[model samples]
Target: MPSLRSIRSRIRSVKNTRQITKAMEMVASAKMRKAQQRVLDTRPYAEKIYELMHRIASREKAWSSPFFETRPVQTIGVLLVSTDRGLCGAINANLFRSLVRFMKERPGVRFEFVTIGRKGRDFIRRSGFNLTGVIQGVKDRGTIEEILPATQLVIEEFSEKKNWQEAWIFYTQFESIMSQKPRHEKLLPIDPEVLTGSGNPPNGHSGEYLYEPDRRDILDVLIPRYFETVIFQRVLENFASEYSARMVAMKNATANAKEVIYGLTLTYNKLRQANITKEISEISSGAEAISQG
Candidate 1:
């Protein structure tokens, strides 16, 4: 059994840790609320752009954009997004696991990865994956311009490289506070169905509209903008998912800390009682010895 002084010191240390975890839990809760609101506000716009893009692609037979052009797969580009910090539970691990599975399946094809956070970059580097670009410190509220440089570079690299056929983005999709799932989505050769969210054509809107500035001309600008929208929404969604995961993880940590403190308190009390009982017995024995003498 440990001494009373040692138990007291341990109890104090655990209490301090509990306090820190509580603080982190509160901070994560506050951030999650803000992030959730931003995600809700942006979803409609992203959905609409996706719908419109899909509609355009489906309506015109000859109308085509480079983004919609599907070619043979040789070299692939993967944009992996994850948080810089841990303690957000399995968010980064889940992403890395998915990436590992994806790379494993396509062993013959070369992979050029673009990592959007410190965790993702460190992961691929440590695993000896070919990293093409690294973007770190992306703000919780990132702008299109912030991601534009990286997006352009990926596009340019794909255009310049003959073997590179497609680009994919692996990220966590935020469904609810309790449910964030790692998703594998193609970022290049933009699938019209993917943008619209409805892989099938909506019967009501298919034949109603006529093109204004020629279908090809409109697609030239819309396709790239559509791609940008996808990237923007993804970053926002990624931020919201991070907050939600962190909030849940911290809450669990705080609960676990409380449990630890409770167990320690019980032990401390038991130890103190034992010490007091031993002292009383010793005192009584001394008195009895003196009385007997």
Candidate 2:
């Protein structure tokens, strides 16, 4: 058993830690609510754009868009999305693991990375993976205009340089407060079935489609918008995932700190009681001895 002073010190330290974790938890919760709302607001737009793109890509008529083109796999581009800061549980770890597995599955393909967050950039740089591009300091709830440069970089890398045949993005999907799943998705050549999912609504029929200038002109506009929308949606989702994971992690830390304080308090009480009992016994013994003397 330790001294009362030592136990009290530990209790005080833990109390301070608990207070810090509790405050962090509250901040994360507030950020999570905003991120969640943004995600929900954009889902409809994302789904519709994906549906429209899927219908066009799935047709046998054969669109000549480079985005839909399938080429020989020699080089692979990866867009790794991670939080700029830590204390977000294993959200980024899950993404890294998925990327590792993907690399293992496809041996001999040269992989280059475009990292959105500082963490991903550091990881890629440290791991000796070729870093083609990096865009950091992307704010939460960032606008499409702000995110467009990174999108353009990836697109140009694929189209202009033709260095990468296929590209994928890794992010954590915010399913719920307690549940965030790491998502690994192919960004290009776009997968048709993934876009359509279970198919579109009744109004999504080809007959309802109308071209303002021409079909080709519509596609030219739609393709870039598709990329922008998808990237923006993922960014928002990662924000929600980051905050949710942080909130849960901080909540756990606070709870564990409280438990530690409770245990220490219990031990301190026992030790103090034992000391008081010993003092009373000593006093009683002394009184009896003096009386006898």
Cα lDDT for residue 31, candidate 2 = 94
Residue 87 deviation, candidate 2, in Å? 1.2
**Reference-based TM-score, model 2:** 0.92
Candidate 2 Cα misplacement greater than 4 A, ranges: 193-210
**lDDT tens digits, residues 107-195, model 2?**
99999999898888888988899999888778896788877877998899898889889988888898999999988788888766664
Q: What TM-score, over all chains together, does every model reach?
A: 0.91, 0.92
Clashes of 2: 0
lDDT of each: 0.78, 0.87
**Clash number for candidate 1:** 1
